[model samples]
Target: MTEALLELKDVYISYLGVEAVRGVSLRVTERDFVTVIGANGAGKSSVFNAISGLVKPAKGEIWFNGERIDRLTPPQIAGRGVIQVPEGRKIFPLLTVKENLMVGAFMQRDKKKIAENFENVYRLFPALKERPTAKGIRLSGGQQQMLAIGRAMMANPKMILLDEPSLGLSPIFCQQLSRQLKALHNEGKTLLLVEQNARMGLSLANYGYVLENGELRKEGTSAQLLNDDEVKRAYLGV
Candidate 1:
């Protein structure tokens, strides 16, 4: 059996004594594309934050590459090749697209690697390459989202945790983003995505977990979840 690349073992997150993530657990294996789909305030972002070390889980272990990482600092966790494209496309509004991408490589000192990653990101999102000098705040919504993904790519992450990558976008842009993500997965990148777009999430990921009220409600292959009447009614809009 292949070992999981990322594992959250009954993780819990609390904010001001309010439970944000309630004993959520899941796994992402090498080259696997996994997703969690739920409505807003379902604690999906909290789970992503815990995996990235932004919010320490009040309990349970976060394991990455077979090591305990719940205790690691955000920077330390980042250095381990787990990167997140946070919700809201949190690009630096004042910075140029190029500048924002460079920020992703704060831990990297090698100019050669940085340059290589620049090419990689540009290849992934050609629109960003054309607007390198443009400020992040000026890009259209789709472009901003692309820039956010490009910026995260600059980190050369081994696995990416995407939070709502398709939020607030035109249908065309969402389609474009989906193709880009599928290409990444095809290239052997491991991904764990959280989204409220259940149809897109299930269509794109190989496996999925349904989150409701901060809890893992279901786990199955994409097709299985898509065919489930309960999931269909609540999330997929069948």
Candidate 2:
């Protein structure tokens, strides 16, 4: 088996004295697409936040590329190439698209490599290439999401943690976003995704886990999870 690029070992995360993720153990292999699906309040996004170092793990460990990262700061994590595109398309509203992307490259000083990453992002997101100077807030919701992912790309991440990327997108836009994500994975980018849209997520995921009320309830290869009676009944609406 390939060594995991990211691993969460019995990770527990809390908020305001209440545990949000309890003993969650999971892994994202290099170049693999993994998704954790759950309903709202199921602690899925908390897992991502912990891995990205936005919140400290109250217990357990998070490892990335064979190094412990649970104690790292959020910026430190991103700088190490474990970038996250948070939910809600949190782009810099006042900055132009190009500027926002540049901010994602803040930790890198090599102008040549930065330029190359920019080229790659633009190639992946042709819509972004069309309006590089548009203020982030001026873009449509789908466009804003594209910018968020493209900005993360500027960081040249070894793996990306995405939180509910389809949160408020229209169905059509969600379909398009899934296509983009699949393309990214197909091109060998590793991904760890937290999504509430179970069917959509499972459709694109190579492997999946189900989280419920702060604990893992089920896990399997995408085909297995999709065909699971519990998953189909609880999340897939089949």
Tens digits of lDDT, candidate 2, 68-177: 99999998888778999998979999999999999889988999999999998898889899999999999999999999999999888999889999999999999999
Stretches of model 2 off by over 4 angstroms after superposition: none
TM-score for candidate 2: 0.98
Candidate 2 residue pairs in backbone clash: none
lDDT of each: 0.92, 0.92
TM-score of 1: 0.98
Clashes of 2: 0
Candidate 1, 41-146: lDDT as tens digits:
9999999999999999999999999899999999999999999999999999999999999999888899999999999889889999898999999999999988
Clashes of 1: 0
